[model samples]
Target: MEHEESNRSEFLVFPLSQVRKEGYKVTRKAPPSATDWSRRATRTQRGILDGSLGHYKGKAVPKGGCSAFAAQTLMKGTKPHRIRIEGMSITHDASATPDGIIDTVLSVMRYSTAVKSDSDERVKGVKGKWSSCMRKAGFQYASPQAAANDSRWSKGNVPTRLETSVAVADMQCKKKVRYLDTLVDVQSEYERNAIAEQSATLASLQSDAKVWLSNAKDEVNKQPATKRD
Candidate 1:
């Protein structure tokens, strides 16, 4: 039990950003604006003025409420469409444990690797595309690695050891469950102590009885001659 506790204390710390980088990237391209030339001209002007129309910039643009045109198209004369700001979506590998007691550690490592690889690929692809777009837009693009090395990204590693410790503890708990029935059926400490005391008392009584019988036989032998006379 002590050894198990010690093992639990040793955990693997992994960076979360590393895991996210290995996961997939969601590319969201808004539907092309309606084919009306007038609308297109207005959109182009808006994009240029608002920094949305040009080649993609390396920096993310803040998306405020949807445009009135988009709301009107969707609502079609209803109260001005309530514009909602959609949240950014992030992708990552699913967490799963491998079967078999001996395989648990290895399984965790494998899962971590799979997640990291997938995330890395996606991040790389996105960085590549972003870099190209930024270049076209006449903006300098920073490498994903550089961004990841920043304080925020540097802080993303997962606590791999902690995860391992949790797994080990869970496994230990499960093993304990298997023995629960037997443990429940076993005699209580008080009952066992009582039984031991009774056995000792019985043994002492048997010894005393033997001693008393031997003495009685000796007394009878000593009186035998007198009784004959």
Candidate 2:
């Protein structure tokens, strides 16, 4: 390898495939196993997926999911946040030219493939309510997403009359029926509960993370300075 990394520097900056052969092997960890971390992380992530079952799914309480809705909607149409961590360090997320570009392109393509999933199915229950609401307003669609992407309404340069009507109706339903608010509530609540339940495991995961960092430092620092370049 042209370069090697070490835990002394708080990073694992070399190519991943050569890590064990040339880098420190992270063999020590706290009580929780790696499998536990993976399982808990997956459970936590599920609440954030864009589906009906995600979010806290809070019951209607007059303001149903107002906090969750605000959390999501307040940032719409804005430039992305540019916050940097003060102490946290990562070697894997560097925005180096071709790698960064390839990573971004792959991310977008992966999202596009979700077109293979039926939006109505992913957000089924809430979508049913939304469709019913729209039907009452003389619009027919399985989900707002489907209405927005309807091939029948894409003939013009801008929105066609039918497209505009469906979009307006969809928005109205989103607002009037508390569909989005409720869904967000459920998703957020689920995440909160999952985090609370996995408290001990999560703490152990942090210790495991440090072990990884230490191993990387050990591996790279042990190598000669000439080999690092």
For each candidate in the order shown, give its overall lDDT on alpha carbons.
0.34, 0.44
> What TM-score does each of the candidates earn?
0.16, 0.35
Candidate 1, 163-200: lDDT as tens digits:
33333333233233322222222323323443354454
Error of 1 at 139 (Å): 50
1-229: candidate 2 lDDT, tens digit per residue: 1222212111112223333232222211134554664456554344343232334546332222333343233222222222212222212221112223234433433333333222333346666888899999997787665665577654544445565555556555765655555544554454455456546544543454455456556656787878563
Best by TM-score, which number?
Answer: 2
Off by over 4 Å in 1: 1-66, 80-158, 167-229
How many clashes (backbone atoms < 3 Å, residues ≥3 apart in a chain or on different chains) does model 2 have?
A: 17
Model 1 lowest lDDT segment of ten: 90-99
